[model samples]
Target: MKKTMKDQKMVLIILLSNIFIAFLGIGLVIPVMPSFMNLMHLTGQTMGYLVAVFAMAQLIMSPFTGRWVDRYGRKKMIIIGLFLFAVSELIFGLGTNVSVLYIARVLGGISAAFIMPGVTAYIADVTSDEERPQAMGYMSAAISTGFIIGPGIGGFLAEYGIRMPFLFAAAIAFVACVSSIFVLKEPLTKTQLAEIAANAKQANFISDFKRSLQPLYFIAFIIVFVLAFGLSAYETVFSLFSDHKFGFTPKDIAVIITISSIFGVIVQIFLFGKMVDRLGEKKLIQICLIAGAILAAVSTMISGFWTVLTVTCFIFLAFDLLRPALTTFLSRAAGIEQGFVAGMNSTYTSLGNIVGPALGGILFDVNINFPYLFSAVIIVIGLGITIFWKEKQLG
Candidate 1:
């Protein structure tokens, strides 16, 4: 029997909700981390290195995890990934030193590599071409909201003690894991499995790996990289920015991010799908990229918290629009090879994350606004690439 639309919607709801919860656990810890480490007497270099390790783990493991998803199935990966995530959160909650925290983060990265690609592939499997952008947009909004609330909640917890945030994070992950166990189901069709196997046989793994590097895929990759670079810089340095500019506390920064995320969510829910349908992916990407460049440049010049907050809402909305469009473009480029495409998507984002913070930290040592300028340049380059990017090659 064919499934009803309600069944498909339920699957989307369950998968996205679990993703939101998982991200919330990570987001909760990020804002208070430097403060937590400061209490433990770790230096900035140590903290940066610890964060780098997490990105490094994801970079190394994601391709293999993506392949496993193609071969094995989404539900299996989701369950195992959620269990690993819970274990990592447990370790993080009980962690006492920078080294222990590093271990927890590395494990968390591995678990995330599994879950993120698996969920994305699941979305690609179930949705039609027409619905893909909107569905992905919803998932992106869920993730952004998790970022919005998690830090505020973490900041409130941090007022008690440094360790409190991790305990809270662990509790969140456990709930997500439990929910996923019952709620998330594999969506792989028999035809889809056969197609993946046939593709696996038709093209040698090496050639397919190289084919995955298509020009259109590069367009998607550059967008992912540029977006991640900008956003990661914002995430890593925003606390410092708020503190220096406004003498704000962690909670204050949380409020600012939460407000910005509200804008992000609205754009994703209401604007992203319609814009993609109307403007098409190419035009949509180009417009968002240009807007993002302008926003980054403006952000460097802003001073007051209220002004920054207002500007940030628009900036995040630009980001929210870019994210789903680019993801849908990449998924289309994959066609039947959902795992490889989703894996590449995650890998580029992680690569950008790796570059963003390290570069932002270097620029920070020179000037507070340097990171924003750096982000603006990267965004402009991405815009140029979008203009020349070949869409026909993708399909």
Candidate 2:
């Protein structure tokens, strides 16, 4: 029994490590995006397209990836996803043309489609219903840690060359892929696999997704979408906005993001699970939405570096808290259809990712503050939807 427990702990560590590396790869290039735009002589609109294209690919692939996770098993999908991430990063690092950058984004999106659902399903397979929230909190902390560390490293490395961070990210992802191949184990039993197969035969991806759209589930999906959209609007234009407003460089932008992400990591690690248990998902979501909307709006008005940092820290804290809460709600509501629901979650998030950057880019060209203002409005609308929603309608 002790040996079994020890093995499970090791497996959990491996899963967390893989997730951390995947997210790190995503965050590592963020500080250098504006430099890429300058090198390509791209406009804000083109930059938006660059950001949105990745999410668009994820949006198209997530449903299929979710189904594949159940059919093929999580371990295989995870390894493949990490391998793709490495290849995509390497391509991005080496490429000079904008077309090649597009190809890299598409590959990265596809890799995310596979990895996100696979990781979520694997966690569900290993954890009991009651323990799932805490597990998810840990997962969120891993992602937060990656975001916290990646930007600092990327910014520092960019001194060597803008491409250096991309290469570093590729190396890290390759290491993760190799580790997953040797260390990761499938959590699903034969019985679970047989049941999953039977269910898969009866329902296609579209059908499974449609069936999961209960009112509570729909609300959960909407929350995920709004959160992603609001955050992405800020993220997609943040460096550019900072540069225009304060003449901040890549290193300055990296420091701001890293500091905000540090607060996010702390919230996810030390407070998220406890808050969810005490407040419940519904109440927590409402509180976060309101707080996030206010902070996001206020963030646009800040003038100094310290002021911006303080506001963004609160904004990130609220966002980080909302993520685990909403995910926990959806996971509890999903029951046995873990992979399908998780895929749908990614799909909605990808849709938001697509729209947010596109709109933000256009608004940024209009005025630097427009994106944040728009995000605040959108978040307020999301809050209103949650307020009117009835819990009993889920049944």
What overall lDDT goes with each candidate model?
A: 0.80, 0.83
TM-score of each: 0.90, 0.89
Q: 1-395, model 2: which lDDT tens digit per residue?
A: 11332347877788888889888888788779889789878787777677778888998888888777887789988999999999999998998888998999899999999898888888877776556677788888998898777766788899999899999989988888898888887777767867886877553556756755767577788889999999888887888899998888778787888888887887787877788778877888899999999988887777888888888888888888888887887777776667777888999899888888779989999988999999999999999889766876432
Cα lDDT tens digits, model 1, 61-172, are 7777777778677888777777778788888878877678888989989988888888888888788887788888988998888877887788889888777878877776
Model 2's alpha-carbon lDDT is 0.83
Which residue pairs collide in model 2, if any? Answer: none
Query: Which 10-residue span in candidate 1 carries the lowest summed lDDT?
Result: 200-209
Q: What is the lDDT of candidate 1?
A: 0.80
What TM-score number comes out for model 2? 0.89
